[model samples]
Target chain A: MAADVDVAAAAQAEAAAPLKTPLHARHVALGARMVPFAGYDMPVQYPTGILTEHNWTREKAGLFDVSHMGQAFLIGPDHETTARALEALIPADILNLAPGKQRYSQLLNEEGGILDDLMVSRSLDEDEDGALYLVVNAACKTQDYAHIEARLPANVKLVRAEHRGLIALQGPAAEQALAAIAPEAAAMGFMSQRTIRVAGIKANVSRSGYTGEDGYEISAAASRIGEIWDTLLLDESVKPIGLGARDSLRLEAGLCLYGHDIDTTTSPVEAGLTWSIQKRRREEGGFPGAARIQRELAEGPARIRVGLLPEGRAPAREGAEIATPEGETVGTVTSGGFGPTLNAPCAMGYVARAHAAPGTRLDLIVRGRNLPATVAPMPFVPNRYKR
Target chain B: MAETRYTKDHEYIRIEGDTGIVGITDYAQGQLGDVVFVELPSIGKSVTKGGEAAVVESVKAASEVYAPVSGEVVEVNSELEGAPGTVNEDPAGKGWFVKLKLKDPAELEGLMSEGEYQNYVKTL
Candidate 1:
């Protein structure tokens, strides 16, 4: 009787918890296979499954409900002072960012390694109010906020955008879907953002995505997010995508996922993120580990990030050892997988500076077998962002 | 046609004459999602009951297929190396991983019947 009561209580608790998203009922109605992800019950795949969802994202439009990612605002007195305060904690050029523009940057530790990569967008209003909008990774949201709060000055504040729900509609037919729902969204250029009403739901829409396809990420109030998700899926081209397909799609695009391709041990220079650091920031030498980064920029870092093309059928997965022709271990594969578009195995890894060049032959040891590989260029499937 | 049996580890064995065809169950394939690669044991290699027979990798995770009965692996489905999705599409039919010449038919009694296998999957 006690065991049965415990089971009943567990079921009751699960039932009592509010199911997130406006489309939760729709997801269930469509027979989506749900899984727990980053504190939210999300669809990993629908009736079509992960493989079909992956292929659809590459060919058509795939709607991803990523409302679980953290959204917040950074407020300060002025832009310059606020940027400086932010640069002290992160490695981004928050000062030079013009209003309405967004920049992708990382929060770095004192050792110059990544804490998390986040997006910072300056608001478009006239006031020099350092009102910056940020979107951080879901898994590290709690720690990221705590770290920022502890390090920020009395004048600076980090406020969670708790009422918002973010969704990413990605792939080749994405623009069509967004245009159908909100015609004004078509004018938003790649990486550019705008505030618009998507199907009568107020949202901040940005032309950014993880699937290497033309798409937009819409952030709306939590109550209205599910409605927008359902509205978009009403279009013939749109289907729900899951985390399984998300990872494979990102891998194929040669994009880096935090906690996988990068960590606290990998510096921006070694991770092939030099372009994210602005010219003024590089010259001013004020950010964390600026001394080390400036030196590494001029003299070149010891190790560099490169894409690996594994020969034959087998995939060279994460943590696989990379070796030279002489059998000496040079580095390790950070992210690797089968590129669905390229129809071959592609990988990203760190190797000695000499081995970073494309066409450099390397050996990836997978399951005790040496898979012949070459250093290749990234984005195995070209990114079709609507620039 | 011989009666099919299942192991607790989620493998299925169908015996006919002295040969036994081994593969992962439908429930196992459903759990693995889309199988991308299948590493089969060498055709001539002998394996003991409950020993590792092959490696099956899906888009989500990797799983090892174990031998249900002691036998020498006489043949393997080389077609899986090219089309691994067969495991997910038709797990019980075309997705058979290997065929072994049984060393001991008595080992088959240790496996579960179809009814028992259904109950085992429910427990999972």
Candidate 2:
């Protein structure tokens, strides 16, 4: 099936093939509405459409080709030393991480603002000598790699896994979809990690997802990933989903998209992600911008992340102005859309800490009209992660 | 025998006597990919030619349907409220938007014919 895919050496393959992922042909054949994203042409949805795809994943399983996301590793002599080195750069608790386990963490700048949120998994080994597997966002991969390489010490090494492709099988039926090839995957708990064979292809499968569903993320060699993807999709319950659905799913799940919800101008505390930072990181203060984070944690941040529910049906799109009761411009919408699952328009933005509480009334200046709004709790739909 | 006409925005209308049947063209529904929700005009509501008469919201974007000729709304496709997907499935058939009593049938003279609409969509 992959005869046309000529896999040269890893370095040459990326430059020669122009970075087409394993599902490229399948997407075209299935009549997927493809769009360019982060240098890769990926399907935003199939002929069935984005709305159907979004609802399908919410009710069944949605298979997504996330190969554009950067996957790499950090290798060192032992786990403790590696963890300590990693803690200096990110806000996650790598030192407390157990073998065969993973943690969601943010790579932060020196100012305690988020650079990118990423997944870090400790290799399943007792000797503590293993690589730290990482999956970074597709759009920020280039800058993230450079940032990591620039900060690493002499003992720690960063290596890019260029030949690998990543796929996310998310939603209610994810476990059943993978049980055919990896039975252990079905038994895996949330945030757990393990190496497994997918349709006989060597892969690292993690029980995690961004869509607020029970799911698994599989990373495998690029040449063999197409086989695994095709095999998983053979089940009638599984359908190919796209970025458009992916965004809606994440938004409904209350998960934040990097550039839209969090950026260098916003800190984790202000973004309502202070829970992800370890207690030790908050106290001992070894990582970058620890002092700022600790102070914000104590005194509270000035502006806070809050959900906005527009009174009318018209969507409050990004950059919409947020105002107080007397028409005082208080905040701006960072991300906004009509959440399919919620069946209503929802938005998220930063507002002054005093007005950040749920039920706080606000007005959105949308299209020259003052749209009445209220601060609602996020994830608009409750996340059903298999913990 | 009368002429069927289309607009750049994708609505198509067939004029018969003093009345006309309005709906989105096959090209419009095809470009929209799939329809999810549709907003129709109230019966007896008077609308002007080229004014927003209805709205068809596909999974991708919401688009306004403009009146082909100034007319009074006589009938609407109530079935669309429950099955807007009909627009994507059969835009020119079961997805007909509305039937209106034309104020000036002469406005029909300004519309593009079926052949012209087909050619127009090709350029897009």
Candidate 3:
């Protein structure tokens, strides 16, 4: 009798249900293993399992449902005003961005810490009227929109693309797969965007991704994403992928997850993303954390993010402490896991400048055991993005 | 004929004369998802009932495998070191973790039967 009540409670929690993406029904149809993430019920992996899904994406084209990501457009009457407004919030040189060009950047706090990392792109189509398209972290979009809205000048405005769903088709075979359906997308260079039609549905496609692969991220109306997903899947080369592989793929690519590898306390220079900041921005000192960032750019950050290759099969997961051979703590692993492509455990962490060199030996304390590790260059798997 | 017993933590012990074959129940492996590494207890390591005796690392998280009854580790399934996913593939069978020389057979009485464990898992 008591057991029945317990079972009922479990069912009740499931009934409460989190938010669902536009492709939620399709995910169920595919027999995907669903889990709650970023306040949405997302598929962690399909029946093929995370290992296979990750491997498939590395070798062939993998279609992912990224609708849960927050998409918005920063609008203004002219490009100059819009770009400068964005530049004031981030450390990137948005004012100089060519139309149709996209740049990865971080939103900064007053202390020069990272608020959230995002993709900022200038409107490719002239009809957009100097509007800049932005994609922020899924969990931070609401707050990011509010933050930008409250700070922007009256000439510039923020418009949430709340009804849009995003999809990412990534990997080595992406070009061939997408060219058959959307020929114009194949013409886009890396970091370039194009507003085109996919199966007659208007979409904004970008030849940029977080997986360190040559791929495309498509933004379309939420109501049309399901049709787009079905059209893409009809082709043999494209297979549905889930968040589980998404994480491993990004980890192997050496990208930092917003809440994991970076947070409010981490600075762009310390996170090994100083390259994203232009020389003009670094010298002029205009963004939110410009002073601290400029100083870090001139004088290297005290500690920087670096990759670690643990010697054994055991993965030293997040929060694992990094110590010197003598056992003095020097750093912490922010993101670590088994890399399917490398077929070995890979990790990234922030360590003291002296200990951040590639091939520097360190010990990782994982589950009470000191495991030998070496600081290695990132993107454990070679990035195959088409130039 | 020997009978099997299960702990509330989802560990199972199959009795065979003076020895008990230990492994996590199928329900536990399902909950763990993909098994990446399994840290087996050293042979001859003594363990007390309800104390941690082994470690199971899954892609999701690591869990401690506790002793259902006091005993000395007589042997471990070394094959699991190479293929930890076996715990998810054949959990109740070839994925057994260790074999313990029972310190007191009377302790088995505290464990649940297969029927009881199924009901317990349903409640969870």
Candidate 4:
């Protein structure tokens, strides 16, 4: 009985401790500041600091360990079955998604609220047409998987690829840096995915990333991730960036961060992600919350997400109240920070439809003071994606 | 000769006559990462011991620089407005946030010396 109790206690302790990724040792060796994030002891920033890392990515290449993000595959008997199964949950028109292409979408509840935003990529190989690759945010993966599993038809299976480690190589020099190892990946267009040999290791490479800059997200076997990371860093242009710069880069790109920018309460239309939903999905009305989404598309969401440029050095961080010049509250900042590339404070927030237009004057209430801001257009820094 | 004292919060005050030049310790600047912005208190603003006198924002987050001892701010570092990186480059010298006219010299006894400060940081 005592032995069983001890074993139970040990299991409890193990579950409570934060999990370390395969690249944890490499991050430590590079003098990264480790912090708890998404149940993982992830690197927040390296000794080079966030500002330098942010600038380096804009000028050169930045490597990021995104292993904490959940990787999974939805498998069925054929492409149509699998696509239809996933379409029932998300509004993206997956059935028309060509092989080797990826589409971004969000899982929604019955009420049209976002469960989690994710990437769905169709298999590149014809023989594996039954499989669709999925990548979801780390913090929401557990619930996301459970939600997906419970709803998926018996013919389709959710295969969690927990053994894979994902990394993003991003910036102007990313292609050149990656071309040295994976020449085939360098030739792929944006949002394209394929199974390729990266540094002599078989891996899934996607010509896409959250940073708006041209980049690739490589998913390799956990055991070989360190080798891939090491080989990528050998290039003079490549530097290991942590979550800090990653957040700033995505915020500047005007991407929605799950839980912060979009949550269970925010719909894709409200978050300005309507572009991801194709015409077929919008008219057919088959997916969860399709009615509400279609209504929002025809009319407009009550509040819409927009890029906010605070008119000063002080950053209006998450939860800062967004108001009119007269102090009437219209919305709240979801993500805000100093953009190293812009050399200014940039943010994203949901404001009432009336105040969401670009160049509209607004005020952000930060620390009891009203800081002037303006509704700016997104991708604060122009996207450098190689089309 | 200037005698410097430190608080557990990592603020430092270098005393010369009745004036004290205040700034964050090198260790504090290192912990805060690259300083992107520094909000200095206005001159003539009176501060109490352990009270927040200025704000320091790094690339990741913002931190408050507390007053190590009570005094009236006689001067503020205007240079930080244009060059915040100076705090990371020379936190001990040019990064000085304010020059305070010491309200009570006895408060100095409550702070740590350089050696004590080093020992305290090691514990953290």
Candidate 5:
């Protein structure tokens, strides 16, 4: 009876109308196919289709409306106080993060499992030295904010930037396209952040993106974001991309999708994210799940995430079982799909340490058929990030 | 002239004497997005009405194309292995998935005519 009630509640939530982003009208005007994503009515693909958009992003600049992602500011009395407050939750070295620099990390539970993956950036202005800009997954923001708020000291506060909308311009030509509007953005290196005026609108521009391409993520007032999007589109090198290409591009880049790849059950060490944990946190052991993470760092994790290249055209989708040639189950695919850049099937999954090496042969069981696959290195397409 | 019939699931069967050429409709291909791979039924295999006949994979997901009526597969489109995008480019022409020997010609009467199928698609 209780299970049925829970199911009904879930159905009711699913039936609720999705919210629209600031650029929703632009997507509809461009004839994009809309789909429900992270509680927002998002464009899955434009009229030109996912293939064209994926290729366009690789060769040119592709503009993406990422307004649904949660943006907030962590405010405290000073940089040290703010960084230490955030470090108590995540494993990254926030205190050492230079001004105008961004770092990627995960909010971990007490048991070493990932709560959510996020990007943290230190403020560039000296007047705002105590503020840290945070970007988190759309689905987990509410809970993440509540969790952080409950644990934070009275001096530090979490301020949600509800009136802001975010957009990402990514690809090899992204720098040139953005430079046309904000010339200062051209000098910013990868993982750097700065506040700039984009066509007379105050915006926070970051030289970072999930796609392993040179790109910028610009955040501005929700009302003015549409103007920035329109101004960027004025560049012939920039084309509007949708979530479909976003998933494919990130998968090809070997980046993790929050809910699919890293979840509450997965740890940063097991997800190949130890690099994000700096030396101070690893040695000082002050953050949540530090013991488990440090132990997993010294003694390797039992299962580690690795890239899978399935032989042939058939894609091995998520939930497909990974097995030995003799049919022994070794792991399961967490994210799998057709990689447009590779022109082949690509996947990432957690496999036993023994079977995680590149060039290792494995089988992906799909539809009761054993498809041959190889354990390959990630970023199936080479990353083109500017230094 | 060959007669064409479409199932509610979007599979189409074009009757050519004893042989029936089968493929998904253009609307189905569009809904599936960019076709990346196609898994065709083997020749000489038997298929039942509404049974899984072939697999179509797009960049987004995979879907099954069911047989419109019971039949024995006579030939398959091997060219789709190398050029799966043809399924999106020419869904009705060269992109036909398979040709099957009809088990019963009368079964065609139960399926929708091209005009009726177009009308049905409008209601969706």
Candidate 6:
């Protein structure tokens, strides 16, 4: 769930030839167990394992080599053209996205289904007022670029930067260690973005992460990312984490994974991502799927994503069915696993609106047997993102 | 002498008389990463060789521990019910999934000896 949902395709890609990230050598040096993720050979976990890494990030700092995620830029003549071009594809208030600030939104189809979830950051550079930096899920990068390119005008170009390496340093101790390299990064407010020199290499740093924690994601030249990575590790508080803990951390934060939690068949409204739609977009209704999204926003989705707390230690894996106690199938789990922080099994899935409220009793059909569970408010663990 | 044998699926059984102590190999535990929970069969449950005898859940995924030999479950490892991580820490000792009374000790012949298993693992 940390990467692509179709792991079979990733496995076939690996068999053909697994693409290694810029930090592959470093991951191997740190004794990481690598697996094919989103067409790249990614570290699933380090020698310390996932639980320790998950808890370490909560108590200390955990470094993640997410260079496999796609980085790109949208170009136009000015902020209005750029934001407007992007708005045509996504349903976020891009025009209002202040410079140096980043916003989360989903790429939707005409049917109101999510094409992909991404982060759009208005460039902080005064000279580049027309450019927007975008980070998209790796597996969807190809189609996503094509999707945007087909829609935008000739002046608004899509620049896919496959040569950039993205690294996320997340945790409570992230600032304490990052300050040693780029002290300016420590001052950036949550969701703020800026370009700074990290370890003598110019990089784009964002005060945001998927981990629902205080963190920074540094985007640098693919070649120099290794240098930036090594420099950050010099601080003893940092430990290398991998996709395993990354998945658990994000799940505990109640964030949706693009391919699993939100897919082409799922709408933002059903995925509980109505928040990413700003008031203007909701009312103006210009973007793709605006009609259905606006209607769903007002009437509420028939089936909605909710958090499930399984009564015991058993994990309800993805694809598990959810049902009422007497045995009427209601929904299915999309992302379900153990929360290392809570030391309990928590899952996120779609259930009927009637069974979606917190404290609603339900049963998860795990391995064909019904297990007792209850709908719970998520961040199954409290979000510690530095506001 | 207590005889130890293994299945190609990475299950192991240490046979003492008609009693077999069953668990996964260290190689399996290594591949499984961190063990989060273990679902053991109930006492008196009869299992056939190659059938699911227990379920092991790791942080990454879940796998079924297959029975290496036909047997009736005698005692289950309660320690795993509380601390499933014991499987990763000490897979052979306290991590044994269940103790079973062999219904037919001859089923052990289909399993590999320690030396054969080590060589088999090398081939993998």
Best by TM-score: 6
- CA deviation > 4 Å runs, candidate 6: A1-14
C-alpha lDDT (0 to 100) for residue A98 of candidate 4? 97
Ten contiguous residues with the weakest lDDT in model 5 chain B = B56-65
- Please say which candidate is ahead in TM-score: 2 or 4: 4
Off by over 4 Å in 2: A1-19, A126-128, B13-23, B34-90, B93-111, B122-124
- Per-residue lDDT tens digits of candidate 4, residues A1-387? 001011001111324788989999999999998877878888888998989999899999999999999999999999999999999999999999999999999999988999999999998899898999999988889999999999999999999999999999999999999989999977899999999999999999999998889999999999999999999999999999988898889888898888789988999999999999999999998988888989999999999999999987887777889999988999999888788889998889999999999999999997688999999999999999889
Model 2 vs. true fold: TM: 0.85
Point out where model 4 deviates above 4 Å: A1-15
Give the C-alpha miss distance for residue A201 in model 4, angstroms: 0.8
Docking class of 6: acceptable
DockQ ranking, best first: 6, 5, 1, 3, 4, 2
Query: Which is superior by lDDT, 3 or 5?
Result: 5
> Cα deviation in Å at residue A83, candidate 3?
0.2
lDDT of each residue in A52-73, candidate 2, tens digit only: 8899999989999999899999
> lDDT of all predictions, in order shown?
0.82, 0.82, 0.87, 0.90, 0.90, 0.89
| Predicted complex 6: DockQ | 0.43
Model 6 gets an lDDT of 0.89
Identify the leading candidate in terms of DockQ.
6
Residues A85-201, candidate 5: write the lDDT tens digits.
999999999999999999999999998899999999997899999999999988889999999999999999999999999999999899998888899999999999999998778
Interface RMSD of each: 12.3, 14.3, 9.6, 16.4, 10.9, 6.6
True contacts kept of 1: 0.13
- Which portions of model 3 show Cα errors greater than 4 Å? A1-17, B122-124
How does residue A308 of candidate 6 score in lDDT?
94
TM-score of 6: 0.97
Chain B TM-score, candidates in order: 0.96, 0.95, 0.97, 0.98, 0.98, 0.98
Best by lDDT: 5
